[model samples]
Target: MSISATEGVGPSLWGLGATTSAKTQQDKDMFLQLLVAQLRYQDPMNPTDSSQFLAQSAQFTSLEKMEEVAAQTAAMVQAQLAFGASSLVGTTVTYATGPAGDDGSPAPTATGVVDGVTFGSQGPVLSIDGTDVALAALHTVTRPGIGPDAGTAAATPADD
Candidate 1:
């Protein structure tokens, strides 16, 4: 016996009637339910191939593992950004203020001591003289009382 094209492929089969932006536990549960339903309603005279079933299970497992790894990686990156930003506290930094000039002129910048660091959705931001500056906007870092020519350190994004 053959299954109809619309029988197992409809949204109703996976309980996906509700729209969602991201995958949730409900979605995973629905996927499992769909798989079970397929098995329960299949033609027993011609059972699903064992290898095909194993491949589908493997794909599900791989997808779950990949999502876990992605979440972990994001957390690690956030922690690293926080650590790097914290280190900038108490150091004088020059950071870009406005957009860069298009006529071969250098972008305007402001120099101040980093008073604190704050983490936001966009990553770490440095608090300097009552202004918030993104970590990525940092041009140089120096010790207190040190001039740019005397001892300037370049700021770059941290790598794994």
Candidate 2:
């Protein structure tokens, strides 16, 4: 069935008036519907300017491309975090821990080999010596023999 914009029927079919703002895909579709209806029912003697229609179409295309770029940037950030974490595997990392004394004091450090990496709500977390350490918590990365117990022989957990 044909529709007319001036009959109040177009708003009901589109769920939103053409004059309303659109922020999402559904809203964009409704906006497009309203625009189409307006074009179809516009006064034939005073038709909309072709340039105006072209401008609106250009704006919509720009908005769509911006959304695509945002999505791709987010994916790229996640991939970078994953790659950085993965590279830490088998390497010893030292991270800050609480004070060595009961009273507030200088922070101590713990060292361990990264066993695995996993994503958490905040960001990537590294599995170090059976403990999950946030990436931000790491203070330094060094060879296995360079930390606090550099010369002490310790049993490897994997050997147990």
Candidate 2 lDDT tens digits, 1-160 = 8545334533365344343434564656666777787788889999999999999889876875676677679879988998998899889899876545768665788989899999877889999999988898899898666767789787877855
lDDT, model 2, position 116: 91
lDDT for each residue of candidate 1 in 1-160, tens digit (9 for 90 to 100): 9654344544465344444225565567677777877887889999988888898889877876776677779889899999989999999899999988999799899999999998899999999999999999999999776764576677999999
**Residue 85 C-alpha lDDT in model 2:** 86
Local distance difference test, each candidate: 0.81, 0.77
TM-score of each: 0.69, 0.62
| Residue range with the least summed lDDT across 10 consecutive positions in model 1 | 13-22
Mark the regions of model 2 whose C-alpha exceeds 4 Å error after superposition.
3-23, 96-109, 120-122, 144-160
| Residue 146, model 1: Cα distance from true site in angstroms | 7.7
List ranges where model 1 is wrong by over 4 Å: 1-30, 102-104, 144-160
